[model samples]
Target: MERIYLDNNATTIVDPVVKEAMDPFYCQMYGNPNSLHSFGTEVHPYMKIALDRLYSGINARDEDDILITSCATESNNTVIKGIYYSLIRTGRKSQVITTQVEHPCVANSCRFLESLGTDVVYLPVNEDGIVTPEILREYINPDKTALVSIMWANNETGLIFPIKELCKVTHENGALFHTDAVQAIGKIPVNVQETGVDFLSFSGHKFHARKGVGGLYVRKGTDLPTFMHGGEQMASRRAGTIDVPGFIGMGLAMELAVRNLEYEATEVRRLRDKLEDAILSLKDVLVVGRREIRTPNTILASIRGVEGEALIWDLNRSGVAASTGSACASESLESNPTFVAMCISDELAHTGIRLSLSRFTTEEEIDRSILVIRQSIERLRNISSR
Candidate 1:
């Protein structure tokens, strides 16, 4: 059986080009970027090139700070906690605002902040799983809100949020705006300057870069407090030695991913739509979120009378990789939270399964995946009805 991996949103296979770019950094050019020795300093030019690629990929300003971290989780934690220490702790503000459909990293950070006595408001998303600027205005108070964090694209339903409009609202209220763009960077055009966002977080693995590498984009003059404390690395903004290989790979990955955004929008979307249309042809199946508003590579569908985990297992047995929802929440064996947040019924909520694609996804794989999914659903439903 040919294995069809449709879980790109969870993580992607590192592009061969990116891997090749990073190979030399492992043992050949191994050096601490912060070291003054020749071995270390010699890597500077390559590092600079990588940094430039990263900046150009995001359209970030020269004066802005891009702090490399372990992954999007670290980047998220840094922005949330940094805001807590810098603004809320210092009496500048007392509350943080975020949507209910956020990934566990952002959601849990808010939950943690709540325990620390910071007012954390999880704004509800509409039936489409979107937190519009109007919804934000209802909860964000200029006097109390220190920061508002929202993800640019939902991992479960692939719903794209209105980042620019939401950021404008947050800024108008004198609060900083941050977005977890982990799912959005490669899938969409993410120009930080155009969004006027104060901070952004992204993971390299989500975009065909190696794991263990991600970054935080802090706008100039943001005054974010330090999240890590140790070496003078990252200009003392973020501590610890840099992952030179990971950085090189991720930078090139970002550049390449952005370069193929057109293909992502056209070819990827066509394949996704083909798969989605086939899934919808099945009885009692509905895709979450409007296809027009979602990222081109994702489909979260609810198949009535079929349990999500059962469907996932059946798909796996057929050599097709899929998920029930966010990979981070998969072990919990619970219903899809994003479905619940969108006010989907308990029955359909538990039936939600997500099939995400990537730039590398092929039309043949989509066709095969659709067949496997249809067979799996039919078998699962037959068993349950028996």
Candidate 2:
């Protein structure tokens, strides 16, 4: 049977062009960028060129703002921990504000800070999965508000948050605002200057890059505490010898994603909508992220009478790949709290499945997926009726 991949949100297959671009980095120029020796320095120029690729793609202002790290998880941890510590040491602020819909990385990071006696507040999001600016402004306590970390785009439901507006609110309250754009970077247009975020985190695999590389876009002169403890790398913000090949892969993947962003997003949105339209037409099925402001490439639906894991397995058997929620908690047999925060019914939350598309996804694959889901739901219904 032919296979169909609808799980772009979890990860995408490494694009061949991205792979081809990485060939020489590992095989030929296999040298640590930190070394001053001729062999090592040889890759320095390539790394610089790659930095140009990444920075230009994201429209970052100063080259100093981009700091490479292991993944978005590390990027997030660095930013959250760094800022929290920075504020505490300077007696600036003591409270952290975020939303319930954040990726587990951000959520857990906040929890960690709370463990350290730092105050943390989880502002609620609307039913459409949006954490509105007004709620943030209402909760803002500048005297104790250290930072506000919100996700620009939710990974599970694909709803795009209003980062720019929220940033304006947070700034008015005298709190630094940050956004985790791991899912938003390549799919939507991201401009650091335009968005006015103090820190932004992005992962390579979220776009077309390899798994091990990601970056934190820190606005110039945004003081923070240390994350990595080692010799010079990422200007000591994230210490350790950089993975030259991984960064190179990240650079190329970003180049492709940004260069073709408009064309890719438009096409993927068309395919995503077709799949969503077909699935929601079935009895007792609801598309969770049906709100107008949701992400273009994300289609979330709930099919009653079936567990999410069971649905995922059944779809897997039929050669259709999708997801229940965040990859960080994929193996857990728990319902997505993000959907729960969106006020989805208990029955539907357990049944939620997310189908994310990519630029390379085709109409035929989407149509095939629609058929597979219908069959799987029917089989599940028969089981339930018995």
Candidate 3:
């Protein structure tokens, strides 16, 4: 049986081209970038080239602005905790602001900070999972605000936030801004210079690269305490021996994504709408984030009278793969915080199923997925009614 994987938001299959680009590094080009030998020196250029590619992909001002890390979790922790520690030492600012719909890494980071007596504010989002600039402006206090961390795009609903405007508001209020762009990067254009974000975090696996590689963009002159302590890797901003092969794969994957961005936006979005429309035609199903500005490849639909996990299991048996919410929070039985924050009823939240696509997702798979979901929902609802 052929499987139709629709969980791109959780992670993506590594592109063949990216894998090819990384193959040599695993055996022939394996060398620690920090080493001074020929083996290391020869491998060093690849890392630099990867950094340059990432810089170009995001339109970052300088290559030095990028700090390589293991994943977006580390990047988020580094930015939020680093800023808090750095500012507390100087007795300048004490507040951090973020949204309730942010990924667990970011949301939990704020919670941890709050426990430590940091004034952390989790701004609420609209029903469409959006945090408007107006809402941000209201919470921002220049005198006490040190940083504002928000996500560029939501992983579940695929809703795109106004990062550029939010960054401007934060700066005007005398605070720095950070955006977790893990789901936004590659799928959309991200120009750090244009957005003026002080810090940005993104993971490679979200965009067809290896899982162990990720990057953080920090504006020049933005002072923050280092998250890791070790050798002079990532300009000493992050300390650890870099994953050479993973970085190579990420660079190639990002290069491909930028080159095909337009096609992904148009074609993928068309396919997503087709799937959504078909699914919505079924009775008693509501599309989450339907009216919001969303990314090209996600659809979160709540199927009434059916449990999300059970429906997903049925879909899996039918060769269709989907999700209930963030893979990071999949182990929990509670409703997703994103839906809860939107004030969605417990019944709807528990029935919400997320279907995310990728450039490789074909129209045939989408059609099959729609059919499978409709059948699964019908079967589950019938069973529930009985």
Candidate 4:
């Protein structure tokens, strides 16, 4: 049986072009980007070219606006905690605002800040998991609002947030805007210049790059609170020498991912829609969220009366790999709060399975997946009836 992968939303496979691009950096072009020697300076140009490619991918014109980290999680932590500390030192941080449906990285960071004397407000999302600017206005105070951290896309349902309009609201109130773009970067365009977001977080692995590389985009003129203080690297924002290969691979992945975004997005959306249509037509299967407004490569469906974990196991036995929620917290026994926050009924939430397609996911896989899903649901339902 051919194994079908449908969890691209969790992470994607590295592109061949990205690997080819980073080959020289690993063996021949190996040099510290921070070194002042000739060997190091020679590789700096390639690194600069790489950074420029990433800027174009994100539509960020200023290269200085980007700060490379290990992954989007670090980016989120650096930005949320970094900006919060900066505000506190300036006597501006009394509270921070974020949505309840955010990834654990942002949600937990806010909670950590709250634990240390700062107030954190978790705004609620609508039925479709949309956070309106009205909710921002209702909760924000001009005198003490320091920063607002929100996600660009929901990992479960692929519901995109209005970063552009919402960021405007936060900025107008004198609060810095930060967005976790981990799921939005390669799947969609994320131009900080256009969105007016002060800080943006993204992981290279999410976009076909290496696992240990990601970045936080801090807009020019924004002061970042220091995270690491030992090494002189990263202009003192974060310490230690950069991962040369990871950085090169990340930039390569971003460049190549953008080249195919337009074509892949159209095709992925077609395949994803077909998958959703096929599954939802089955008896008692409910397609979650707005049918057409979701991500191009993701489909989250609820099989009425079956459990998600059980369904995943059966599908795996049948040669399909899937996920229940964010890969970061998948091992935890806690229920997925994203579905709960959306108010999906306990029975439905228990059975909700996330099938995220990718540029590499073929049409045949989708067809085979539909059959497997139908069989699994039927079997599980029958077992329960017995």
Give the C-alpha miss distance for residue 341 in model 2, angstroms: 0.9
- What is the TM-score of each predicted model, taking all chains together? 0.98, 0.96, 0.96, 0.95
Model 3 TM-score is 0.96
What is the C-alpha lDDT profile of model 2 across 1-386, one tens digit per residue? Answer: 98998899888887888878788987788878777898788988778888988788878886447888989999999988988779954677889999998989999999999998889999998766688898898888979898999999999888999999999989888888889999887788888788888999998988887888899888877887669999887777778889788888888888888887887567877778888889879888888755467778997887888777788899999999988753233566555678778877766667788898988788999888989999998999899872
Ranking by lDDT: 1, 3, 2, 4
lDDT of each: 0.91, 0.84, 0.87, 0.83
How many clashing residue pairs appear in each of the predictions shown?
Answer: 0, 0, 0, 0
Q: Please give the ranking of all candidate structures by TM-score, highest first, separated by commas.
A: 1, 3, 2, 4
Global CA lDDT computed for model 4: 0.83
Candidate 1 root-mean-square deviation in Å: 1.6
Winner on lDDT (2 vs 4): 2
Residue runs of model 3 more than 4 Å from their true location after superposition: 326-330
The parts of candidate 4 lying over 4 Å away from their true place are 325-331
Residue 375 C-alpha lDDT in model 2? 93
Q: What is the number of residue pairs that collide in model 3?
A: 0
Model 3 weakest 10-residue run by lDDT: 325-334
Choose 1 or 4, whichever is better by TM-score.
1
Better of 2 and 4 by TM-score: 2
Between the candidate structures 1 and 3, which one is better when assessed by TM-score?
1
